[model samples]
Target: MPLAVYLLGLAIFVQGTSEFMLSGLLPDIAADLGVTIPEAGLLTSAFALGMVIGGPPLAVATLRWSRRRALVWFLAVFAAVHVVGALTTSYELLLVTRVVSAVANAGFWAVAAATAIGMVAPDAKARAMSVVVGGITVACVAGVPGGAVLGQLWGWRSAFWAVAVLSVLTLAFLVRVPAGRGQAATGLRGELRVLANRRLWVAFATIALAEAAMFGVFTYLAPLATGTAGLPASWVPGLLVLFGAGSVLGITVGGRIADARPYQTLFAGLTALTLACAALAVLADSGPALIALVFLIGLLGFGINPAMSSRAFYLGAAAPTLVGASVTSAFNVGNMLGPWLGGVTIGAGLGFGSVAWIGAALAAAAIATVALALTLRGRQPVPAQARA
Candidate 1:
């Protein structure tokens, strides 16, 4: 890996922090803005919606631009939006800022993934991806909690200010990254054509399903830990940190093996994830067991990420930037879907433990989706032009 790859990861770390930090600031935002807590929560949904709808179009628009230029522009926009969000008194304006920030973040992610992979050898693609995606897992562990502490000390706006500052610093460092368009710098038409690949859709489905499964359980983890698992309320943060630690470990290990044996790695990780969810559903009453299962769930859930991401890039080889955008869109779709499903289940009077059941079912579906992808790949191998 080159220094540019690590720099891309650093940029992602800053963006990832901004993405997840809101979980801790929602109450403060609602109180300050005179909105209901649910309305404040909508800010997060707005961000996810923006990412889902904005990424592919942004990718297409920037297809011919230099990667470094696109990245720098996106980072500038992201930093600017956060600054606006930090200073806004109107919830409506803040909501718009969140959406704009997410769109910029999505654009940056799409370009960054393509740029990082372009900096590395083919055989090292998964490892390079792990380095980049590891930013999010690390954010879950350190950034979210740290943001909460900042919110407590100063105010929620302080956290937003912090993210804006970090994004500017990251932008400064990212200026040194290479400025070339990636290998698949095909024009808009060629990139759009890649969207017709059935196998690529299958890969997207696998990624989406896997993420839906993981987040279904994760969204309600604090409640599950306190209500069902009989843990102290104070223990929730530590459990979250533990889960994040497990995720870092999982991605690290998955990165090393995914390139060598992608399908096998997916199978092992998804299967373990399904089992972990099932175990959590059944053993939610046991505090120690619940704690262990939370860590295991995070491990197995994120462990498959490298394989899924590698498969997307492999299948969409003809349009790396567009495919990267599509991958980002698919991920946010899952991020939205999983929590929605969990909320529905809980609203229907199912216990928090039921989310684990939902997780299990989603993971099983993901396993089946991966199998279909493998079959599709076997039937129609990558075209020679794409392999070029």
Candidate 2:
């Protein structure tokens, strides 16, 4: 593995920790700020919304800088935002801070793995990208659990402070990595043209739909557990650990699947996702059933991420960075929509089971997107659709 991959992993760790810690700390935040849990959850939505709005504009605006400098400047902005987030007391102020932090975050994801892939040898690209993305799974497996523990031990705000410190470490490590081959603005403009292709939209749709369903329930999982899963509040953390473990497996293995039979794995994963969501919706009446359902959902849902990512990589070989960031933006789009829909359903007195219905619908949409991608890719007559 290149040093760049390690640095990307670390950056992702802090970034993931910074973004994801909201769920673990929400209860504490609610208590401290005198707000309902649902209202407090806007912190997560605010971040997701930031990523959705910021991913492209920032990437396009920073096109003049080398990928390395762009990443550094992004990390710098990200670190400052975390500091601001830690200091803010008013709920509205914190919301604004989270939006700023998420902008930096959107830029980081847009460039980091794509930059790392450029740094290493060609044969090493897939492995390097996997290692870079692995940080997200690692965050779920460890960083988040640790943050949750810290929240339990001290306060929710401390976790953000911890992420801020980690950001510094990530920045220092990232500084040492070579910039690799720099991308030009022409390449970005070329990427914009590529984006207009119908197949690319299909691929983006596939990613967005899958993410929305997966995260929708995940956002409100703690409550989902209490409502339908029947798991005790104490058991939620451990269950999350299990989900993290499965996610680690998914991320590591997803790459291999992409290398082997990309389309097959994708279709299978989407199909399984639909079935899993349907099954969970039907079975989400009690503790043990919900536990089994949630685990199955996590295992199956996260298992295809690498496959989906790689599919986009191959399909969008024209403009890697733009497509890469666009896929991530699609991810946050799902992130924003899923929870909002879930919250609406829950607020409407629809139980946790309603989440599965949404999940199933999204899964169906994802499969349709994949079908469209495969169809368009197979029929693409022009050898050079755009540029890489």
- Specify the highest-TM-score model's number: 1
List RMSD in Å for every model shown: 1.2, 2.2
Q: Each candidate: what lDDT?
A: 0.89, 0.78
Where is model 1 poorest over a 10-residue stretch in terms of lDDT?
Answer: 180-189
Alpha-carbon runs more than 4 Å astray in model 1 = 182-185, 385-388
Give per-model TM-scores.
0.98, 0.93
Error of 1 at 41 (Å): 0.7
Per-residue alpha-carbon lDDT of model 1 for 1-388, expressed as tens digits? 7888888888888888888888888999999999999999999999999999889989988887899999999999999999999998999999999999999989998998888877887888889899999998898889888998999999999999999999999889987899977434467788888889998898899888899999888888989989998899999889889989999999999999998999999998999999999999999889999889989988888888988997888777778888999999989999998889889898999899989898999999999998898888789978664465
Writing each residue's lDDT as its tens digit, candidate 2 over 27-91 gives 89888878889789888878888989888888777766778888888888888877887777778
TM-score of 1: 0.98
Error of 1 at 310 (Å): 1.0
